[model samples]
Target chain A: MSQGDGIYPDDLKYTKEHEWLAVHGSIGTVGITHYAQSELGDIVYVEVPAAGAPVVGGEEFGTVESVKAVSEIFAPVSGEILEVNPALAAHPETINRDPYGDGWLLKIRLAEPKEIDALMSAAEYRKYIEEEAN
Target chain B: MPPAAGPLKTTPLVRLFRDMGARLVDFAGWELPVQFSSVIEEHLAVRGAAGLFDVSHMGEIEIRGRAALELVQKVTCNDASRLGPGQAQYTVLTTESGTYVDDILVYRRGENEFLLVVNASNTDKDFAWIASWARGDVEVVNASARWAQLALQGPKAVTILQGLLGGPLDSLRPFRFLETEVNGTRSIVSRTGYTGEDGFEIYLPPQAAADLYQALLRAGGPHGLRPCGLGARDTLRLEARMLLYGNDVDETTTVLEAGLDGIVRPAKGPFIGSDSLKREKERGPARRLMGFEMIDPGVPRHGYPIRVGGEASGAVTSGTVGPSLKKSIGLAYFPARAALPGTRFAVNIRGRDALAIIVPTPFYRRPH
Candidate 1:
């Protein structure tokens, strides 16, 4: 289900740090939330782990750098990286343009299925950001 | 998060910032816009057309008395005697150890009157430091509250400002300023800016700030002037290689090491840090600030370690992907021998070493 204006999709699970997980059976596509990309003015460069790398929940897998500061991107769930987005290296601004779709950073095979249940739903994530704004 | 220690100050144009949909953040105890549209868009607008900035947050210290020049010369590293009426000079307040207290601009308002503009973050400290050296007939007043500053920068800056003034702005040479009226408000217009592009900085009364800002926006709208914020300001200055006080230089770094030798004149005779600076010049600075561009994928960031030949070398002070240059550029301190242009080093970015090469600064110079 698509959220209004496609900012946050209902099918995605979110982490407190703003990473979104789109579960597709056992494989999940992970990327930063729209809030995350908006907070980082311009995405000049992104460093992602190569395919086949192991990523654990709550561990930093890469960094998203803007012109002003660098932000660490944490893995939402423990998994093995199946593929990393090749478009990010050349056009990091894609994260700011289409954070939910083409901006997906990686596709991973879940190592902890139970971790997905603990993630926040779309409605809960919206409330989290609303409280954060206040 | 806990609230700030003291109440945050707001500029006269704070309302205007909010009206323009600006994203405001707490910068050095002041509520200022970090960006209006986007950093890259605003930055490019300054490079291609023009951009207006509210620089009222910058501190203004007024020194007035017969001994004003003497007090200024004593506290700053540059020779203030060379400044005639209506001229400005980039100078630095140095400590006894030949380290930076703050980098400032000295504007000669009159023969015995001077206005010192300092970084917003170090306003209190700089005022206190300058006041400590005030003696004789001079009086130091923190006049920041009375004045507001606006910087209109880019290629079309002159055209936009000249339209507002309805005067011959081309006659104003670099580093020169004129006391004139702009849109019925008295102003100090100077042909100076931190950005490497041609621009004008207008200093006027706080009460007249909002009106003049609105007038400029209306006039400059057709000329493609965007309202810029601190985000674009930082990137623009970085692309120009202008040093940001806390980021590029601090009390631990000397003028010589920061590559600002042009402003430090030892021949001018006794001044604060002159002796230590002379000694350092004779012995040669151990570390020097150099500009570099990343050859690898990763972007170097502040406090990132620099390694040369697998040995720890130095640390990056400022780093960014230059919007104009479209490359990752930064400034770092390196051993004197490794500070030359074309020298190669590795920046430790997130546990990985990224290759970078030293390059001559002012990374983006405007084509005349």
Candidate 2:
């Protein structure tokens, strides 16, 4: 997906806090959207929950820090963290350069598959950001 | 929630910043750009090449009369009697309780006239405080509205400024200023800056700010001069270890504890905070400001608690990722015993304790 101008893949589900989820079977890959990274300016540091940590939906799972400020990353759905992006520890700027690819924050095993339906679709997420900008 | 309702004051360069798609924020009642581009990019640009900054929000006060020096010496911690014409001194407006009223630059304009450039947020308070001290033979005038200021800073600063000046600028020493015309606009160009780099600060009439800004941008475009904002300015100054008034020092922070003892000369004799400062110097400050770098992968921010041996020791004052050094560095006040370089401490970053160690400041010193 071209992230040059705020691309939101229709195949993924998004949270109001700008986290996007790509589900593969029972595992869901999570990363911040291009808009989130752009609004953050430069990603200097990111702290994610350890693998096996329980993540509750609508709860903070981690934090994204820019040079200017710190923002909390919210969990899109209840799940168990399976993996974290180890590459982020050394090169957090990858979140700004390629937020959806190498910058994926974590992979999780969904505790409730029905929770995915609560997230917004790609079109809804686009409109949500438009309202926020206005 | 709806946006807070209030009219924001703007500098002459507001439209220019808006035109450049600068991210504007409300700072001390003034609508100013927080960043023109990205903070790191603008910060690196200033360190490698040059960056232009709109610093017109800073307040300027003029003191003129036979007693100008006396009034200045009474309120400031530095000895102004030693300054001759064209020289500037980094000083502080101290309160009677031995705390900082504001950190300012004392520019000796003439034998009986001086100018004080102070922080933006403290302008009104400073004016009132200084005016209260003015008596017979001394006149304090708030000239903030009459002037605009721009800082051109970095390694290429001199070369870029030299291109627009009619006279030789190589002779202008650091901390000294020259009153001259730049592209026909009257200005006071000073070899001073907060970025820990060689640069010049141009103070001119508000009406001439826009024109000079554009002219300098056009002249400096080929040389890689980017228009920076407060975000870059903060990171640059943090790397330089320059104290910000509200963050690093405030009405509660004394000059002695702020690690600015070099600027305080008690031997020069009686000032507003002299008595308390003298006592503090003799007895030694209980707490001292120390610079530390995070040993872990978290950013230590302002108001975060600093821990020593699992116990709270102090609180962070100013913290940021030092772009030049590419590390998380910050300033904090620790007990005298724990303020030494190499002392280990941990900062509470969002409930997680991030290990840090005290280090010698000016985290990123420019190559000479």
Candidate 3:
């Protein structure tokens, strides 16, 4: 999505910090939402935890740096990292281009799947960001 | 977040910027556009063609009277006596200990009159300093609110601005300015800019700024003159190795240590920091601000700890993934002995050390 264009797929859950999680059984995929990447202007660098690292809910797992500022990425639920996007380091701009699809930051094996209930749904996250922009 | 004083101040071009879809952000307590499109796009636009900027937030001070030159000479480090009418020089307002009060551009309007363009956040402080030193026949007035500034910079800058002037701008040498009519509005047009490009900085009455801003955009549309914001400005100036005041140099850093010995002229006379500068020059500064590029994977950020030869020395002052060079470059203070072209250091980014090497700066010099 481009600037001012908002897209929140109903299959995903989002955090107040703007990371989106896609759950499938015991595994989940994570990436920053389109709203977050647009607000960042341009992504130049990204640092993520290695696979098998433990992540806690609402805790910082990595950092996303744009041309002007740096933003910390917080996990929405507790999990163990399964895999990280190896292509993200050299092509950080991919997050700004295809944030939801190819720009996924990491894959995790859920440690507390019930924690997903606390995340905002697509419709709620859309409203959450709309309120944030004001 | 809003500053403690009140809402962020807006420039005269704020509405126009919003109309053009600019992403506004708070910069030094002023609300200004960070970018219209993207930093990389705007940065390359200035390098390839031209880019316009609303720099109206910058402070302007007029020093007028018989002792104008003397008051300016006493406060600033550069020798303002060498400047004649229509000439300008980049100088610094120094403190008693030879540290920077602020960096400014001194423009000589006449033998007994001058104009100082200073940083936006340092306006009141700089004015107070200049006013206190105002003895004899000098008058210091903060004319910041009375003017609006527009910088049209890059290779095509001259061509884009020449049509607005009644005379040619081709003959206006760098650092020279003239009081002329811009789009029929009385303005000060200077052949100087921070982007290291051939350009003009036009200072106009606030009332005439909005209309002139649009006119220039219309005239420059064909030349690919995109309206840039502070994001591009920062990146462009970084590539040129121009230092930002609050970040690169502050009260703790002396002019000599900031790599600005060329502007310190103690031999001319005793200015605010002249005595201290002279002492420091004789002994040589212990530390100096130097440029470096990360050799390992990580981006150096401001306030990041820096280690020179494995010992904690200083902090990163200004850093970014250079939009032009595509390298993580930054400026940092290091021990004088370690300030060399090939000297290697480590930047502590969130407790992780990233190896970096000092490199020759003005990292991306444009082809002449």
- Judging by TM-score against the true structure, name the best candidate: 2
Q: Write the per-residue lDDT of candidate 3 for residues A7-100, one digit (tens) a residue.
A: 8888999999999999999999999999999889899999988998999999998999999989999988898999999889889999999999
Full-model lDDT, candidate 1: 0.91
Per-residue lDDT over B1-368 for candidate 2, one digit per residue giving the tens place of the 0 to 100 score: 12236898899999988888898989878899988879999999999999999999999999999999999999999999999999999999999878999999999999999999999889889999999998789999999999899999998888999988889999999999988898798799999999998999999999999998998898888899999999999999999999998889999989999988888888898999899999999999988998999998889888999888778876899999998898999999988877899999889997888899999987888998
Residues B1-368, candidate 1: write the lDDT tens digits. 13247888999999988887899989888899999879999999999999999999999999999999989999899888999999999999999988989999999999999999999888888999999999999999999999899999998988888877856999999999999999888899999998888999999999999999988888889999999999999889988999998888999999999998889987888888999999999999999999999999877778999997678987899898999999999999999988899999999987788899999987988999
- For each candidate, the alpha-carbon lDDT, in order, equals 0.91, 0.91, 0.92
Docking class of 1: medium
What is the lDDT, from 0 to 100, of the residue B179 in candidate 3?
Answer: 95
What candidate 3 gets wrong by more than 4 Å, as runs, is A1-6, B1-4
Better of 1 and 2 by TM-score: 2
CAPRI grade, predicted model 3: high
Q: What's the DockQ for every one of the candidates?
A: 0.78, 0.89, 0.81
What ranking emerges by DockQ with the best candidate at the front? 2, 3, 1
Report RMSD for candidate 3: 2.0
Q: Which candidate would rank higher by DockQ, 2 or 3?
A: 2
* DockQ metric, candidate 1: 0.78
TM-score of each: 0.95, 0.97, 0.96
Report the Cα lDDT for residue B49, model 1. Answer: 97
For residues A59-89, what per-residue lDDT tens digits would candidate 2 score against the true structure? 9989999998898999998899999999999
Model no. 2, DockQ: 0.89
